[model samples]
Target: LHPAQDIPNARGTALIAKVKKPYTEDPASPVRERQSVGIYADWLPAPASFGDYDQFEGIARIPGQISWRFTMHQVQEDAPSWFGGSPWTGKFDEISSELTVNTLVEVRPFNSKTKKAGQAVLQGTLQRCRG
Candidate 1:
């Protein structure tokens, strides 16, 4: 989801999204089951130049931890090689600053005997490191 506003001390805003669904059941264990769910993050950086936009996105499974990182760059668009070419053709840009996210999620499985669905808890922190 979108943030209320751009984060202070951060180049731009960061967004997060999550989805949950039923996972395949284990045939070996009738009582044990898994849940299908994931959390995703998108970090957008402030514009470095006119029409210059950069962003990073990543996903991690529930009940686990993962890290996401990305670097920003500023590139110059090149002239079209042929007629009706896209404007994205350009020289590679120099790497700029980088962003990193360390996340942890804990998921409690559903209790089939009790007929209760599971729950998930998430914890994480974001850091802007040197490029």
Candidate 2:
């Protein structure tokens, strides 16, 4: 079974506040192994507001890869004020209300030698991690 099989088409963006270092279960293995990374974020909806904040902590894993880049942008509720002389400046401030999260993930087989990807399987549950 593979990791990406069960992930339904998820849409919308979330604010990622923290990203942990990538770790693997079998660290001593010579071959490529699955690496997991922890991410803490606040998921917001289209009309993002303070009242609609949902705190979430998720783990994203990539098989056979040591490192990967994930980027997140800060979305503020208040729009920045524009000064005179700027193009189309007339107290206009509505662009900051858009919700977006652009992430591109490429998953490959654990065995790098194989050109095709293996069967995709989705596993794992969203649970609260307590101290």
What would the C-alpha RMSD of candidate 1 be, to one decimal place? Answer: 18.8
Q: Write down the TM-score of every candidate.
A: 0.18, 0.17
- Residue-level lDDT of model 1, residues 1-131, one tens digit each, is 22323322222222333222233465454332322223232232222211222322222222243332222222233653333211111111111222224433221122323434222212243333122
Clash totals for all candidate models = 0, 2
lDDT at 17, model 2? 26
Q: Residue 27 in model 2: shift from native, Å? A: 25
Top candidate by lDDT: 1
Instruction: Give the per-residue lDDT of model 2 (tens digit) for 79-99.
Output: 432431101101111111211
- What is the lDDT, from 0 to 100, of the residue 93 in candidate 2? 14
Cα lDDT, all candidates: 0.26, 0.25
